[model samples]
Target chain A: MTSQDLFAEISIQAEDFSLADEVALLEKDNLTDGAVVTFTGRVRNNNNGNSVTSLTLEHYPGMTEKSLAKIINQAKEQWQIGRVKVIHRIGELHIGEQIVFVGVTSKHRQDAFAANEFIMDYLKVKAPFWKKEQITEAGKTSENWLDAKTGDTDKAELWS
Target chain B: MIKIVFFAALREQLDCAELSLSADDVKTVNEVKQRLSDRNSQWRQTFSNASLLSAVNHDMVAGDHLVKSGDEVAFFPPVTGG
Candidate 1:
């Protein structure tokens, strides 16, 4: 496999992933990078004044991966980064569960940090995934679809 | 016929996952939406949502994007996941 193929990966799975594993895979002993940055997003217990019991993530199967690849490609164009790996989970996730992972390695910390943040900001607005919450209110249970936050859109726009 | 699909909350709201329409009757994604919206009041409301997003052949596109036979069109709400 080529460097890009081995270093970069985008996966959408219902199964959970290990950060240590992804970290090891990203670098793979190439040792050319001086800095590594990674970010992990998890399911929160509360949102919008409701206690969230679980979250269900949904995406258009084929398009989700393609969109993520497009985002990664954009990052590759904008930064001198080494390996990049992105993992996003779908299906039911209870509170405190890991939802997403983004890792980047670059020759310096600046590119690593900037590229990591850029991927996350754009992923929120550009990726196809949507979230629905199973929430509890007044001792009753209900489901609500989470709306895209305006702040996220604004944050992404800042990069452009 | 161009295949049309819905995802996430939009699919739940419409109670539809996928459907098809003759390409001869529509030119752009907007026209396909207009045709679908004409089915009833509920459809019209759903289609009228400004935040509604569309894609042709799995690539995100605008309402004016042209559609052709065998192209798969998808509609959904704005993304929220990271």
Candidate 2:
């Protein structure tokens, strides 16, 4: 990997990302990388049994990227990760649409897997992102912002 | 002056995203919440919610975190993302 690949790249956009392309970018020309792990989160048609029509992801402008970088940096400190790339989608999204992507490259499978999971676990609560679910039932449409689950906080705390 | 911002559901409930405050009026995150709560019943109810979270200069902090002029403070509900 080159010096440019030494740091993590974080993108907050409204456009969807290709998982193959993102993973390829992380592994491209990285001869030392022995393992790569990628995780994609997609919007589901139903959340908690409600028929979710769509999801609108909201994030704090400057702080969103900052928090992601912080999570990536934390992962680097704990594992021997090579390249990390995180892309999170915002704005409106329909059911089954992609919401977030996290890819990590490392010299071994354990490191890559652990780092990938770590970034995602922290992103759940540490990053300033929120999800609002649009539900339609019997032709009546309503929306509610999803609250952070206590389980997410517990998972993040376990990392420490 | 200090900058304060709200995000997500908190923004919708408070009907605000950002505001400016004189640093002299508040010295900590808790003080800012108290001042905001004094604005009206709606604000009081919103800020007083136990689940509300806050940050100073983009890092999560507790209510007692000290703040000063030029600081950026944010308030929001717990984040829900993956």
Candidate 3:
């Protein structure tokens, strides 16, 4: 099958996210035993002991969606996935704001959990998003942001 | 001419996303990269980065792969998508 059929529930946005709606949509398919697992990643106000006030995320426009689509297709190939939803936010964001969400529905909890973890691991290492953290300090001002975590690469490698 | 594109951190660091190089004697992605590397030291550093990825005609490919004029060659860091 082509990539469009597999990416029925993929979104990359700049607005705030709704986790409940995402989970509900992921569980919409039939022949499911009602097992759904989700993982939500939020933006924290600190990075490497620095107090971050906000984060500015940048990404490659056309390439970002293409890469995410491939990652979702890979997940579908590995497991008996019913429905999957992935939402990633770009642009400026504050602390505690939702950054990403992954919802997986399957016949059993094992598959759901596995899919959730798989999506997250792959996203961390494969997504085209980059973050720049703006730090607020008492006396000095410094902005710091790093590349996607190397630990994430290790995690994704384990699945391969 | 060959159209080469850059993305993400590579784009940010290089200050431009698209470049046109003379396709004469350029037959592969490696040849295109080498032509670019000869232009400036920055291009060399970007290409020398081992983690970078290459794409030809919108499909990811190895550097040694053959290419032709008007081919779209893109280079970027390893994908980090979920």
Candidate 4:
């Protein structure tokens, strides 16, 4: 196995990210990594039966990056993973636009898959990010902050 | 002084994003909430909500967490990100 340093590859920005470029960066100069798993979350056109016009993500500045680093470190402790990259976009996002991405590389497929899921799950709850949705329907429009669902919390708890 | 911040819905509802309070006046996270709630009816109602969550120095903590000068305390609703 090729020795590697544990690092937190995180980006919190308003700009979009290229998945191909991100994956390539993860795979570049890494001969030990045999499996790479990636997950991308996108804004949907409809949510809870309402037409979602757009989504605005808000996050704590200093804490957001720290939380992501902590999460990546936790994943490293649980699995034999290397080069985990997490990118979450903030500010206004249109329907079908990407919101977040989680990529994990490992020597085996099982470790890669498990670490990818673990990072996403922990990011949902542990990270201090929130989403606000704008809805338009029948010539009327409304905006509200999306509440964190109990199901999401429960899902995160399952990993613990 | 300690910095107190609100995020997301809490920020909108309270019409406040950030504020500073003297550390001598508040010793714990709960004390800060109580002092803020005492400001007005709207503030009282918002802070009184049981679902409100808080963090001190960027890490989630319970109400009894002791705070010090220059520390940042944030309150917000549960996170809704993936």
Choose the strongest candidate by DockQ.
1
The CAPRI class of candidate 1 is high
Cα lDDT tens digits, model 2, A1-160, are 4643565899999998998788779877888888889999999999888999999999988888889988999999899999999999999999889999999988899999999999999999899999999999999999999967889989989999
Lowest lDDT block of 10, candidate 2 chain A: A1-10
lDDT of 3 by residue, A36-128 (tens): 788888888777788888887776666667777787888888987777788888888889989888887777889778988988887787667
Going through the candidates in order, their DockQ values are 0.87, 0.85, 0.43, 0.86
When summed lDDT is taken over every stretch of 10 residues in candidate 4 chain B, the lowest stretch is B73-82
Off by over 4 Å in 4: none
2 or 4, greater by TM-score: 4
TM-score of each: 0.97, 0.97, 0.85, 0.97
Error of 3 at B75 (Å): 2.5
Candidate 1 accuracy as lDDT = 0.91
**Model 1, span A21-140: residue lDDT tens:** 988887777677888899999999999888999999998888888888898889889999889899999999999899999999988999999999999999999899999999998899
User: Which is the better candidate, 1 or 2, if ranked by DockQ?
Assistant: 1
- Candidate 3 matches the true fold with a TM-score of 0.85
Candidate 1 vs 4: which has more TM-score:
4
Task: Pull out the clashing pairs in model 2.
Answer: none
TM-score, structure 2 vs. true: 0.97
For candidate 1, the C-alpha RMSD (Å) to the true structure equals 1.3
TM-score of chain B of each: 0.97, 0.97, 0.92, 0.98
lDDT of 3 by residue, B1-82 (tens): 8888887678878898898887788988888888878879987887788878787765668889998888878887765333
DockQ value for model 2: 0.85
Q: What's the chain B TM-score of candidate 1?
A: 0.97
Question: In DockQ, how does model 1 score against the reference complex?
Answer: 0.87
